[model samples]
Target: MDDIYIILVASLFSISCGLLGSFLILRRMAMVGDAISHAVLPGIVIAFLISGSRDSFEMIIGAALLGLITSFLIEFFHKKANLQTDAAIGVTFTWLFALGIILISVFAGQVDLDQECVLYGEIAYVPLDLWITDAGLNMGPKALYVSAFILAAVIIFLSFGYRYLHITTFDSAFAASIGISIGLWHYLLMGMVSMTTVAAFDSVGAILVVALFVVPAATSYLLTRKLKSMLLMTVLLSFLNSFLGYYLASTINGSISGAIASTSGVFFLLAFLFSPIDGIWIKAIKRNFDKSKNTSKTKFNKIFKE
Candidate 1:
């Protein structure tokens, strides 16, 4: 069914982004995903110009390369130029994004890329974009295959590099002292993020990709402290976001991507207010209960003294 296909693709993309996003959040480089998403625009344009086609594979290859360069520039500025990390990210993404706009303007006739499609995406159209065999067999939506492949790749990357990523993320100084190449792992992580971002473009677009990258992970962070638990929760939340978002969009006749993104935010708000670990409402209730208990104890002491 088209509904199933759309939700499946969204869930896969959300899980991939959330898996990588967990680490990015811990590393305080969550915005790097945002940077790469925007910075890859020029790559898409360039790929279109050279290939003279809007093939997904060519666009991904080009965008992935630009994403890597964006990562490098951010790191280079932060480390070598001694700029703050935020500053580095700001400088690199804006410059590249502006350049992409310039290129689009200059070659308006050649490039068929629409800014709205790039930013907002059209997940509702996934079922229509089927991959057909040469013999005329329908292999389902191409977005489904791409999302599944990316999700598998992300799982493999995290499984193998968990130790290095965990150590480097939480204790960079200790990791460096132990001779673990933090920079190498950092770039590798960034590379994976780049690939995932590019792959999700057709399914969710850049804006929703960034939301999926950061929201589920962040929401899980509030629910748990253990890295493994957080990851599991993130995956669960990703699925919930996708399913709920789809139904919500159908009910309202709205954009699926926008609805999914809004659903992620709603979930995040719930976690922020209700998470047992450190939720604001829970903390407030605990504080008031403690105050009441202390007051009762003081009263009892006064009565006993009297």
Candidate 2:
């Protein structure tokens, strides 16, 4: 696959993950995405057993369903067992992840499962795969094409349900009072998240999907108060980070997903230090400048009185 195609696919996948993750972060459910990402492993294993192949479509469906199950289990423990939400998520994910590991270990030589491959995903070979055939161009890296479609699907859904999604993102209680069906929205959001993360698993790996999901969106939220502005900025930042990070990784012989995550980390750090509204340096500088102005005003008044 062409290098440009790789960049395009990475951008599409990263942006899709980031957009869905914005809501997760707003609802304080960012870690839920992480939990679902890891817990889906057992689902993948089961899917392999039942389907007899690691088909992308089957894996996606299986992972999404398992993600919903993870959500239900978390809710169950939180509501019925009176467990803390974070603790519930942590427990559920690790146990499932461990079960997946055990399954792989037990059937090591018998099946097509690798623990590192499962955890890290396979982004490097995305360009070599052919998803589209019979065009003037090879239309390389079918993963990019598929991911772009996924991103478009998310955008369309969000567009059509903008008002309801907005209300739910800001305040679920208020959304429910207004007949928005917060429960439905919650499932819908999780479903999209599940799809995006699973799609990303082919290229960016599981760990970086978590990074891509949260960091760009969090940075955008910190940089802008308006949701629209945040969304636009997040998309742009995600694209740029994917392209530049991939180029850097290729040039330096480093992990592409890790490079992208580190690049996003740098972006978050920039937002933390430079965002005008809530940035640490911005606040500190404004405080010192305000103090200086007040001191100058007081000195001027004293001089006039003298």
How close is every model to the real structure, measured as TM-score?
A: 0.92, 0.90
What tens digits encode model 2's per-residue C-alpha lDDT throughout 1-306? Answer: 367777788899988988888888988999999998888888777777777765467877888898898898999999999999999999999998898888878777655878767767667777787756666566566786788789998899789877888898887788888788988888888888887777787687667799998999999999999988888998999998998889888989988888888899998999999999989999999999999999999999999977
Candidate 1 residues lying further than 4 Å off, grouped into runs, are 52-57, 294-306
Clashing pairs in 2: none
TM-score of 1: 0.92
Among all windows of 10 consecutive residues in model 1, the one with the lowest summed lDDT is 52-61
**RMSD in angstroms, all models?**
2.3, 2.9
lDDT of 1 by residue, 27-81 (tens): 9888998999889889888988998875466877898789989999987899899
Give the worst 10-residue stretch by lDDT in candidate 2: 131-140
**TM-score, structure 2 vs. true:** 0.90
